[model samples]
Target: MGRWTGWVRWGALGAAVVVLVVFLVAQRQSIDVSYGRSPSSSGTVEEGSAGELSDATVPSVDEMTAMVAADPVVRLPGSIAHWDEGLVRNAIGDADVRILVAPPGLDKDERGRVRDVDNAQLRVLGTEVTGSIYQAAADDLPSWRAQFATGDVTSLLVTLIAGIRDQDTPEDVDLFRWRPPTEAETAAIATDLRATGVHIADGATLTDIPKSAGPAFPDGGALYAAFPQQTFGEPVPEYGPTLAALFPGKPIVVIYGSWIEYHGPNAADFTDVVGASFYGQAADRISTYDYPQANVLHAYLNRVTDVRYAGLFERPLPYLPLDPLRVALPALPWLFAGCVVVFLALSARSLLGPRRGVRSTGPPARLAGLTALAIEMSGLTDEKSDPALTRGITKLRAAGDALEQNLPDGHVGKLLDDAEAELDDTAWTLGRNDYRPFTYLRGRLA
Candidate 1:
């Protein structure tokens, strides 16, 4: 009985330990899908309000210009040339700003421009550059947009190619002899531009211009003024299941540039930072001298500086909901460890606990053998007058009574009852002079 009880206790403890191990292993292998919030608010933007540039406390153009001209210019080979630095400095005067000259064709070579901006000592708020209007009108807009998107600035330059002459020789061209982009083309281009997060500037210029060309474009100033006040009515496209799977819920913002005619109708809707272009007859001459024209750079600086100084670039962080499973997953390891500790403590106690020795209540096993021996020895004597046989039977019956009172109620007790019955039968056979029972009993005992 004692041995059986010990086995049962050990089996239960072993089972508990197995369960704890399984739980700990499962927790260690579980997947978590939640993400934490970003510390900086720079790249993060809220949903549905991606392109909003509203701020009542925006600085004026003069204030923005002063702020922008303070910083040194970061120039690239393909960017506005070194010769044109004086023109840019003259326009910005002594304000703080970092200007990066990144042309469309110079993909990775533009790294120096970025580094220069980073090295500047001023409060470099943002960067503005003139991209090729021709390249943007073509399919190269995506790559250009990608380059600007990776920059620290929130906006970029989107030059317009509509109504601009593409003549190779500046002298033989007519400025008025140009065609505007159709409404369909403009809408399609606008959609694509928005997808790339490119910021557009109004008042584009002709591809070819002589040094004599002045700021004679009719819509140049009006386009610039209307840029900040224009709002787009087109709905942004859904990212779809494939993009969602790839990026989850990543944010996208598009910058737009348009002529006064194109965005004038919605000008009142956009009451935020506006972008205007200074590239026309007067500005084109300075930029055409194997370098980005000074007047064009100045105009870009003025507009971009205004936007930056007005605090329109900083956007709020997108709100991401906490995932319940992800939050709970982290606690699993701790819980598992605690359960294992408890199980081990319990097992240790059971193994090292003081044990109570079990005592037997039934007659000793050797007594049964002795009783059988006595019966066999008496069998040789005559049954009618055998006093030894009578005494042996009486002793066996007394042993049976003691076993019935003291033995546990199980297999051992049943064996005791059977032995007592056999003893009575032996006595009866001896009394009747039937020697067969005694003979069988003696052989079984032997």
Candidate 2:
């Protein structure tokens, strides 16, 4: 019985452990989010392809603010900042705005793409940039900021050379005069000019580039060009379509170069306009004036353009505590773990019996028989007794004591049989002269 009880206890404990382990394993944190895409999306701005815009209905800034405010996942260790739509509109006139919320510790790759696209949370509210050049511009803003911040180049010219249209070329062009180009500058210029399909005339100076390039600059700003400090291995693919859109013709030269022999006027106005139009003034800031979030939204849109439709997506239930106990939400997991341990302890106790004492050995029947025999032997003795019988009774009492103290089953049975035979003999001896045993027998004989 004791052995069986022990097995039950150990089995219950093992089962409880298994249950806890399975619960922990199954409860590993995970989330699922699905986004909408445009029909022409390729997840990136491919070469020679127009950009695709997502048709997903992104919530407004106010709506998103409320949603994010309510979410416990992003409510970690910081105060939530609210963005006013009217404030943004006042800053950047009727432009698109986007916001990206990603898991903490994840960052973008060198190509200006989210490292984990599937898990990225995106929201957009405004007109989408459908042109590939515009999309590329948005994507490259981050890279451009990094390059400029690191002092890779002093100045760059993003020239848009379109066929002279309704707007005529300016007569007094604030052209940055040029001197003899260094070997490096000349080589960089030649390589960069190929992208715009422009070739410099032999023995021609940089001042004459406007005429030589066969295209007129819009409103005729500065008719100067500088080779770009090539940061990436290849120019971003979006630049082609961007130039194509601004300039209806080819030979639209965009170049980057160091401040080589500063002898000419600073074309800051021309360069600043181009930079701001493509990359915002403050490229790093999340405010509407620069709106880096818009770029993020555009990037996400391109990736998901292939999604036929966007709709409500089911998310895993968040582990948020009740509002009253919001302060304890962070400790909720630990609390659950503690509860599981407590439950296991209780279950084990119930299965193994509440008391912690030794289990029964199941020898009650044998012990009871020995006790009854001892009582009967005592009863056989009285005040009227023979010395021999009394001596015999004393011997039986001594044997009974031996039986009570750890006697083997075979030995106990033999002792018991001997005691029974003796008791019968004693009864016969005591009752021999008594008429009670032979009353009917004596009457029949008469």
lDDT of each: 0.33, 0.32
The lDDT leader among the candidates is: 1
Mark the regions of model 1 whose C-alpha exceeds 4 Å error after superposition: 1-11, 24-74, 78-183, 186-366, 369-446
**Tens digit per residue, CA lDDT, model 2, 1-446:** 12323355466556556655655665658553434222332243432232112222233445445555555122212111122334323333333322333211111221133212222222111211111122211234343432322221111101101011112222221112223444564454445454543433333222223231111122223222333223322332223223333344332333332111111122223233334433442332221111122233332223222221322122122233345443544555665566556656655644543221111222333334333433544455444323323443454565566666876755654444344333333333345322111232233233
lDDT of 1 by residue, 92-144 (tens): 44544354433222212232343333333222112233322222111122322
Q: What would you estimate as the lDDT of candidate 1?
A: 0.33
Error of 1 at 27 (Å): 5.9
Q: What number of clashing residue pairs does each candidate have, in the order they appear?
A: 18, 9
Predicted structure with the largest TM-score when compared to the true one: 1
Total backbone clashes of candidate 2, pairs 3 or more residues apart or in separate chains: 9
TM-score of each: 0.24, 0.20
